[model samples]
Target: MRANRMPPAAMQCRPHTGEALSMAASDARSGRLGFNRLQRRPARDRYDGLARFFHWTFAACIVYASVAGYTLTRLANGPVHHFLSQLNMSIGTVLIVLFPFRAGWKLVRAEPRAMHGVSARQQLLAHGVHGVLYLTMFAVLASGFLMVPNGYTFLGLFEIHTPFQKGPLTDALFAVHRASCALLAGLVVLHVLAVVKHQWIARNDVLRRML
Candidate 1:
C-alpha cells in the first residue's frame, strides 16, 4: 500500500511552526541585548584610595585623642596622667602638622556627588557639618597646643615647643579646647548616626562609597 500523505492544511502549518521558532529566537536575542545595555551602564563613583586612607586615619586619631584627653583631665596628678597627657598632646601635634596636607589634598581632589535621591537640603546640611568639623578640628588642635604652659616631648622622640606661657591666657585656651572637643565629639556622633540611617533605614548604602 502507498504511504498516506498529510493534509494540505497540516502541510501549510509546518511553515508557521518554523516561523514561530524564528520569532522566538529573535525575541531571545533582543532580551540578551537589553541585558548587555544595562551591564554597560556606568558604575557609581567612590572615594579614591588616598581619600579613604585620610578618612580612616582622621577617624582613629580623633577617637584616641578625645578619649585620652578626657581621661587625663579626670585623673589625679600622677605618672599615669602624665603619660596619657603626653601621648594625647603628641597625637594632637601630629594632627596639626598634617592638617595642611590633608586640606590641600581635599582642595585638589574632587568629591563625588551626593547619592541619587538625596535632597538638596540634605546635601547642604552635609556640607555644613563637614566644614564645621574641619574648623572644630583646627580649633581643638590649636587650643590644645597653646594651653600647654611648658614644652612637651613628643613620642619621646623630640621636643615640641608651645608659643604661650603659663598664665590666664592658657586657662582661656584650655576652656576653648574643651568646648571644641565636645563639639567635635557631637559632630562625630551625628556623622556616624547619619551613615547608619542611610545604610540601614533608608537602604541607601552610602557607606559603601567610602569603603
Candidate 2:
C-alpha cells in the first residue's frame, strides 16, 4: 500500500516571501540569551559580556558624578562635603580613563538586534539617539574629570600625575559639565519615552531585546 499523503490540490506550500526576520525577533532572542551576540556568556539572566560591563561601569560613574554635582552645587563648604567631593572627583577621573576602551568596544562590536516591528525611520532615529547618547556620555565623563579642583591623580597601582594646576579653568569646566548634564538628562527622558512607547504602548517586546 502507498504511504498516505496530502493530494496535490490539498498540499500546502510556502512562497519565497523575501521578508527576513525583523530586528525585533533578534532582539527578543538577545534578551533571552542574555547577550545579543551568537556566543553566550557565563551568567544567565545577566547581560552579555559587553552589556554587563558597560552597564555597571557607567552606572557607578554616573552615580558618583551626579551626586558630586548636586553636592558641589549646594554644599556650604565644609570637611564632609570636601571629602565627598574628592571621592566623587576621583570616580569621575577613573571614568575618564576607562571611557575610551568602553566606547571603542561599542564602536567595534556588532550592536544588539533592533526590534523588528518598527519602521525604517524609527530604527534610524533610535540609531541617532544612541550615537548622541554615547558621545554625550563620554563628554560628560571627561568634563567631570576636568572640573576637579587642584589636580587629579589616578587611583590605579601608581599615583598618577596631575592633569591641571588651578581651579578656575576646572571650575569653568564644571559649569559646562553642569549644563551638559542637564541636556543629557533631558535626552535620557526622551529616550525613555521612546522606549516605553515602543514597549508599553505598542505592546511589543522591543525593550526586552536590550534588557
* Most accurate candidate by lDDT: 1
Candidate 1's residue-wise lDDT over 95-124, tens digit each? 888888887898888677578778999999
What TM-score would each prediction reach against the true structure?
0.77, 0.66
The C-alpha lDDT values of all candidates are: 0.89, 0.69
Clash list (residue pairs), candidate 2:
24-115, 24-116
Show model 2 residue runs off by greater than 4 Å: 1-47, 152-160
Q: Kindly provide the TM-score of model 1 when superposed on the true structure, using C-alpha atoms.
A: 0.77
Model 1: residues >4 Å from true position, as ranges? 1-44
How would you encode candidate 2's per-residue C-alpha lDDT over 1-211 as one tens digit per residue? 9999877654433222222345567778778786545455333422357765776677657756676777777888898777777677667766777778887887776555555587889889888987898888877877766665556445433444557766688778878888888877777778778878877888776555545
Best by TM-score: 1
